[model samples]
Target chain A: MNAYWQCLRGIVLREWLRFVLQRTRFLSALVRPLLWLVVFAAGFRAALGISVIEPYDTYIPYEVYIIPGLACMILLFNGMQGSLAMVYDREMGSMRVLLTSPLPRTFLLCSKLLATALISLLQVYGFLAIAWVYGVQPPAMGLLLALPALLLVALMLSALGLLLSNGIRQLENFAGVMNFVIFPLFFLSSALYPLWKMRDASQWLYWLCAVNPFTHAVELVRFALYERLAGLALAICLGLTVLFTLLAVLTFNPQHAALRKPG
Target chain B: MNALTVQDLSFAYGPCQALCEVGFSLAPGRFAALLGPNGAGKSTLIALLTRLYHLQRGEIHVGGHSLRDAPRAALKQLGVVFQQSTLDLELSVEQNLRYHAALHGLSRRHTDLRVEAELARQGLSERRREKVRALNGGHRRRVEIARALLHEPRLLLLDEASVGLDPASRLGLNQHVRQLCREHDLSVLWTTHLLDEVHADDALMILHQGRLVASGQVDALVQEHDGDLGRLFAGLTRPTATGAPA
Candidate 1:
C-alpha cells in the first residue's frame, strides 16, 4: 500500500539524514577494514596462501581473496552498532515514539532494520571503491552481480544484531557483547582465512567455521563477486536471516521486561 | 461516546503491582489531569494507555475503537507527548514533524500542509528550519506538541510534559494547551505530580500507591476532602509506618 511505502521512505530518509550528520561514523567504519586490507594483508601475504576455491577459475591474489570478508566486516560492525543505538534510543525515549506509531510493531522494526542495512551499503561500496583503486578489481559484470549478495548479508547480520540485543536490556551490558559476540563471529569465521586452512589447523575448528552463519555470508559474497553461485551458502544465509528476524521481533518486549536487577 | 475510556486496568512489574483496578474516562473537549506522587504508578498508567506496555487485564477504548481489539484504529485516534524529549535533536524542527507524519502514513503533500499548519498554529513557523538542539526547553516542547497534533487525533495525552521547565514556562505550556483544547475541541489527559498545574474547574484524578484515591471536579473534590490541596495530597499519598498506604 502507499502508506507502507511512505512509512518506509520516511524511515530510510531519517537514517540517511542521521548518517550524513554523523559522517565520522562512516570514516570510523572504513578505517578498520582499510587497515586490514592495505596494511595487514600486505604484511600477511607471504604468510597466507592464496588458492583457487570453487566458483573461481583464475588465480586471485591475497588482496582480492579477503575483500569479501572485509566488506562483510563493515556490515557486522554496523549491524551490532545499529542495535546498540536502539538500546540507547530506548533510554532516550525515541524507541517509545517509534513504538507508538499506528503501524504494526513488526512492520516498524523491519523497516528500521532494512533502513539500517540500506545505509550500510554505502559504507560497503565506499570500501569496495577504495579496493578497486588499490588493485583488487573483480570482473565488471561480477561487481554488478555482487550487489544483491552484499545486501542479503547486510540484512542477515542486522537481524542477528537485533536478536542478540534483545537479551541486553541495559546500555551498560552492551560493551561485553562487542567482545563476546563480535570477536567470536569475526575471528572464528572465514573472514581472515578460508575453511580449508581452518581444517588444516584443526578439524574441530574447521567445523566451527563451517557452521558459523557469517562464514556462509562471506562465502556467498566471495562467490557472487566471481560470477558464481554457492547454492548452499545462499540457502543458509536466507534461512538465518528469516530466523533471526522472527526471533528479534518476538523477543523485543520492553514493557514486559523488568527494570530491576537482583543483587 | 467518551473521547477515552479505561476500565479496571491492572498491571505488574514482575512481582510488584504497578497499577491496580484503575479506571477513568474523558469527555469530548474536556481537559482532565492525572495527579499522583512519584511512586504512585503514573508512568505505568501512561505506558499502558500509549501501548508501550501491553494490556494485562483491562480494556481501553479511544474514540469508540477498542485498544485491544482494534489497536491501529484506536491508536490512530490518539496522540501522545512523552515526559522526556523524543524529538531528534540533530534533526530540524520541520524534519521531526515530517518524520512523525510519515510514520502515520500521511501523503507527501498532506504532510507538507499539515507541517506548515502546525508550525503556524504553534507560532513556530520561523524556527522550522532550525535543529531541535538549537531550540530552548519551551520551544522544543512546543515543537513536540505541534508534532503530536499533525495527525489530528481526538485525544492528547501528555505524561509529565512540563518537567524540567521553568515555573513560568510550565504555566505558559499549561495555558497554551488549554487554549488548544478550546480551539480544536480536543480532549486532553495531562499527567503530573504538581498541585499548581490543576485549575479548580479541571477534572482531577489523584492516584496513590497504585490505586486512584480521588477523582472528580477539582474544586468539589478539594472541598469534600480537605480545606487545602497540600494537606489533602499528603493525607492521601502518605504511607503508614507499617508500609501500608494511608
Candidate 2:
C-alpha cells in the first residue's frame, strides 16, 4: 500500500538522519575495518600466504583477499551494534514508541531491519572507498557488482542481530554477544583465513568455517567483488536472511523484556 | 457507544497475578482518571490496552473494535502517552512528530497539516525545529501529547504522563488534556498516583492490588464516603482494609 511505502521511507529517513549526525559512529565503523586492512592484514600477510581460492583466479595480496571479509566485518559490527541500540531503545522507551505504531509489528520490525541494512551498506561502501584509495582496489565494475551481495550480507547479519537481541533482555548481556557470537562468527569463518588454511590447521576448525553463515556472506561478497557469481553463497545468505528475519519477528516480544524484572 | 471498554481483563506474570477481573468503560468525550499506587497494576493495564502484552484473559474494545480479534482497528482509535518519555532526544520536535505520523500511515499532506495543527495546539510552534534534548521536561511532555493526538484517535490514554513534572507543569498538563476532551470530544483515560490530578467532575477509577476497588464520579464517591479525596483514597487502598472490588 501507499502507506506502507511511506512508512518505510520515513523509517529509512530517520535512520539516515541519525547516521549522518553520529560522526563518531561512522568514523569508528570505518576505523575497525580499515585497521584490519591496514594494520592486521599487513602484519598477517607474510605469516599467511593465500593460494588461488575459488573466488580468486590468481595469487592476490593479503589485503586484497581480506577486503570482502573486512567489508563484511563492518556489517557484522554494525548489525550487532544496531541491535545493541535496540536494547538501549527498549530501556529508554523509544522501542516502545516503535512497537506501538499502528502498522503490523512484523512490518515495522522488517522495515527497521531493512533500514539498518541500508545504512550498513553506506558504511561498507565507505570502507571500500577508503580501501580503494589505500591501493586495495577491486575492479571498478566489481565494486559496483558487490552492492547487492553486500546488501544481502547486511540483511542477514542485521536479522541475525535482531534475532539475538530478542533473547537479550538487557544491555549488560550484550557483551556476551560480542564474545560468543561476533567473535566466533568472525574468527571461525573464512574472514581471516581461507577454509583450506583452516584445514591445514585442523579439520574440525575447517568444517566450522565451512559451515559458518558468515563464511557464505564473506564468499558472496568476495566473489561479487571479483565480478564472479558464488551460487552457493548467494543461496545460503538469502536463505539465512529470510530465516533469521522470521525468527526475529516471531520472538521479539517487548513484554518479555518489560516483565523480566519483577513488579 | 463507549469509546473504550475492558471486560474481565486479567493478566499474570509467572505465578504473580497483575490484574484480575478488571472491567471499566469510558463514554465518548469523557475524562477518566485511573488512580492507582505504584504496584497497583497500572502499567500492566496500560501495556495490555496498548497491545504490548498479549491478553491472557478477558476482552478490551476501543471504538467498538475488539483488541484480541481486531487489534489494528482497535489500536487505530487509541492513542497513548506512556509513563516514560518516548521522544527521540536527538530528533527535532517536527521530525519526531512526522515519524509518529508516518507510523500511523498518514499521507504526506495529512502529516504536514496534522503536524502543523499539533505544534500549534501544544504551543510548540516556535520550538518545532529544536531537538527534544534541549526542551525542558514539561515541553517534552507537551510534544508527546501533541504527537499522540496527531492521528486524532477517539481514546487518548496517558499512563502516569505527569510524573517528574513540577506541580505547576503537572496541573497545566492535566488542564490541557481536559481542555482537549471538552473541545475535541476526545475520551481520555489518564493513569496516575497523584490524587490532586483528579477533579470532582471527572470519572475516577481506583485500582488497588490488581482490582478496581472504586469507580464513579469523584464528587459522588467522596460524598458517599463522607470524607475528603485523600482520606477516601487511603482508606480504600490501605493494605489491611477490606475494600470491596467494584
Please give the RMSD to the true structure for each candidate, in Å. 1.9, 1.5
For residues B105-215, what per-residue lDDT tens digits would candidate 2 score against the true structure? 899999999999999999999999999999999999999999999989999999999999999999999999999999999999999999999999999999988999999
Runs in model 2 deviating more than 4 A are: A257-263, B241-246
For all predicted structures, in order, the TM-scores are 0.97, 0.98
lDDT of 2 by residue, A58-103 (tens): 8988999899999999999999998998898888888877777778
Which residue pairs clash in candidate 1? none
Q: Per-residue lDDT tens digits of candidate 1, residues B23-71?
A: 9899999999999888788888888888888899989999999999999
TM-score of chain A of each: 0.96, 0.97
Instruction: Give the candidate number with the greatest lDDT.
Output: 2
- lDDT for B36 in candidate 2 is 83
What local distance difference test score does each model get? 0.89, 0.91
Quick one: how many clashes does candidate 2 have?
Answer: 0
Runs off by more than 4 Å, candidate 1 = A256-263, B242-244
